[model samples]
Target: MASVFLLLVCVGTLLGSAGAQEAYDRLPSKFKLGVDMALEMRNSRAGVKRLLLYFKGLGQSDIQPGNDVTYIYHNFYMKATQCPKGTVDTSNCPFRNIKPEIDCAICYKTIAGKIQASPKPYINCIRKPALTEAMKRKRVNYCNEMGYSSGAPGGLADIGDTYF
Candidate 1:
């Protein structure tokens, strides 16, 4: 009886892992990068959550929902823009009634391993204390490989809005 229970546990663990990997495999390449970057940035939960959403949207996952902010925010916080560009499915989305994905800036960048500074429209747009400049640059490069840039397609991603 004990042997049978142990076997069941082992099989269950393997099945769970396979299911997670399968879900990850179904996400778009950019979303995949976002997941990696999120993990690297020490925010794996949010990143994995986002990836699961993608899988769910694609009919790949029965557990995770695939709606909310589609882009990976450099800050590790989910800043969802409302309708037209992003998903309006969430009830607590403060960005409600807005259009255009550009309205949300979810990217961080670095050139030569140095973080580029920019104008801040938000009153509380403060620097992320946890991430260093080099790490920020690396994340930006990861997102770039995922094919997201500012205001256009394929090219040097804008320093501010670059995400995937």
Candidate 2:
């Protein structure tokens, strides 16, 4: 009975190791998938908004101007301008009409500085290379933890064959 139990333990260990190796093999492909997803997200308006919000909320107050203020200001300006003059009587104007008049100089300058200071969100506005790099690093670490080589023969394909 003891010998049977030992044999079972060895088999379980081997299976577990093989499963781990298989997982490692798939890491590159998973990394690529993550990168592709990020790229797709970056191309979308909602995705851009989410990323901007994330960066803005991460205590990167500098990015808040561009991500929030500038965007909101522009939208407001456009909406206000869309209404033809005299279309709505000013006597009943609900909100103060500061459009095209107030200048919003401080807000504009602040947003401009934010835009200039950190252009990563803009550059990543289309591709998100930084996110891709982060994903790559994560996959490398995961592969290492699984005792596998990310640069193994056939690269991602080898992992796909075994796992996916």
Query: How do the residues 1-164 of candidate 1 rate in per-residue lDDT, one tens digit apiece?
Result: 99999999767655644554465577655444544443334323343222111111211101111222122323223222222233334222233112211111133232332222431111111123444556555544544443343322212233343333
lDDT of each: 0.33, 0.26
1-164: candidate 2 lDDT, tens digit per residue? 99999999767655644443343344433222322233344324442221111111100111122233221011000112222233332222122123221100000112332322221121122222233445433433333222222122221222331221
TM-score of model 1 vs. true structure: 0.32
lDDT of 1 at 136: 51
Best by lDDT: 1
Q: What's every prediction's RMSD, in angstroms?
A: 17.2, 25.7
TM-score of each: 0.32, 0.20
For model 2, the stretches where C-alpha displacement exceeds 4 angstroms are: 29-164
